[model samples]
Target chain A: DVKVTQSSRYLVKRTGEKVFLECVQDMDHENMFWYRQDPGLGLRLIYFSYDVKMKEKGDIPEGYSVSREKKERFSLILESASTNQTSMYLCASSSTPVTNYGYTFGSGTRLTVV
Target chain B: EDQVTQSPEALRLQEGESSSLNCSYTVSGLRGLFWYRQDPGKGPEFLFTLYSAGEEKEKERLKATLTKKESFLHITAPKPEDSATYLCAVHSFSGGYNKLIFGAGTRLAVHP
Candidate 1:
């Protein structure tokens, strides 16, 4: 079975603090994604990395950045956390387009900014 | 622009009731249509993937069918544990990145 593990399930951070959310997949997938889910808005993509050291901005990428230094690990970074940034963050990974299986998502990290 | 939309923002049903959820979409070229189930406080779980119109897939009581512009997920005789939010997403072939555009989702609650 494929497993996507998140560093934290719940986190609380103060305003202006820098935060890091880590995601690691054991399947060695090539594509990793970060998304923030809000009530009534669905899942909005923040950023995605297709390969090591390669990244792309998604629909809502402001105030967020991502790092992929290894094939199995991806990290989401919040430069300066704010109250408005509080939400559930999800990490997912999938193989390349030709193999095109749906993403396997992490349990999710619920981050609260105060 | 490519877009995805789901209907019935919320649905309430009794155990053993059968129903269907709708997902409508518009994309330049369709790559795949996916259905997922998300329980409260958990990540969405993949259920089925339909590649073309008239394609159908089933898992237990859940059945997913695809059309040219829409997909339907049918639940037959559901149980209380089947309650959750159903999400639909579309992948566009025109877009180089295989990013999935998701819908807001349909929240389904089944009471015993």
Candidate 2:
């Protein structure tokens, strides 16, 4: 079975603090994504990396950045955490576009900014 | 722009009741439509994927069907364990990089 693991399941950070959320997938997938889930807005993509050292901005990428030094690991960085940034973060991985399967998502990390 | 919208923000049903959730979308070219079940505080679990109109896929008591502009997920004789948030997403062929546009999702609650 494919497994996507997040570094932390719950996190609390103070305002103006820098935060890092890590995600690792064991499926050797080529595509990785980061998304934030809010109460009524659902999941909005923050960023995605298709290969090592390659990244693309999604719909809501402000205040967020991502790093992909290896194909199996993706990290989401919050330059300066704020109360408004508190939400559930999810990481996912997929094989490829041509013969794509659904994404395998991590359990998710709930971040609380104070 | 590719967009997806799910209807009936929330639904309440009794055990053994059957109903359908709707997902409407508009995109340049529809590559795929996907359904997922998300439990509270957890990531979504893949349910089914529909590639074209008239295509149907089923697993246990859930059936998903697609049309030219929308998809329907029908739940048959649902049980309490089936309660969860149902999400729909659309992959646009011209969107570049196979990015999926998702809907807000429909929350379903089943009573025993």
Candidate 3:
């Protein structure tokens, strides 16, 4: 089975501190995505990487950034965490367009900014 | 712009009750529609994909159908274990890539 592992299930960070959420997929998928889930707003894409060292900004990439140094690892970074940035973060991987083959998602990491 | 809307923000059902969730979308060209189930504190899980109008797929007690502008996820004889947030998303060509637009989701609760 395809597995997307997130480094932490929960995290807490102080405001203005840098935060990193890690995700690793074992399937060698070509596409990786980071999204933040908030109530009533649904899932909003933060950033996505199509290939190693390549990235694209999603709709809500203002306060976040991403890094993809290898085929299996995708990392989401918060340059300066704030209280409003507290939410559940999800990572997903797919071989192509998610609509074509669907996506395998990590369990998610709930980040709390204080 | 591609957009998706799911209706009846929340639903409560008794065991053995049956109902359907609605998802409506507008896009330049509909490439695919997807249904997902998400438990509390977990990532959304893929359920079904509808490629075109008149297409239908079934798994156990869940059935998904698509039309020209909408999709419906039918739940039959729902049980407590079936309670979860059902999300709908559409894939459409945008800015030279197929991007997914998601709806707010329908939260379903089943009582025994």
On the 0 to 100 scale, the lDDT of residue B57 in model 1 is: 97
Candidate with top DockQ is 3
Candidate 1 to native Cα RMSD, angstroms: 1.2
Per-model lDDT: 0.92, 0.91, 0.92
Alpha-carbon runs more than 4 Å astray in model 1: A98-100, B93-95
- Give lDDT tens digits, candidate 1, residues B1-112: 8899999899999999999999999998888999999999899999999999999999999999999999999999999999999999998654466678899999999999
The top-ranked prediction according to TM-score is 3
Chain B in candidate 2 has what TM-score? 0.96
> lDDT (0-100) at residue A61 of candidate 2?
94
Q: Write the per-residue lDDT of candidate 3 for residues B3-98, one digit (tens) a residue.
A: 899988999999999999999999887888999999998999999999989999999989999999899999999999999999998887787776
lDDT of 3 by residue, A1-114 (tens): 789999999999999999999999999899999999999898888999899999999889998989999999999999999999999999999988673547888999999999
| DockQ-better candidate, 1 vs 3 | 3
How big is the positional error of residue B75 in model 1, measured in Å on the Cα after superposition? 0.8
Model 2: per-residue Cα lDDT over B1-112, one tens digit each:
7789998899999999999999999988888899999999899989998999999999998999999999999999999999999999888665366787789999999999
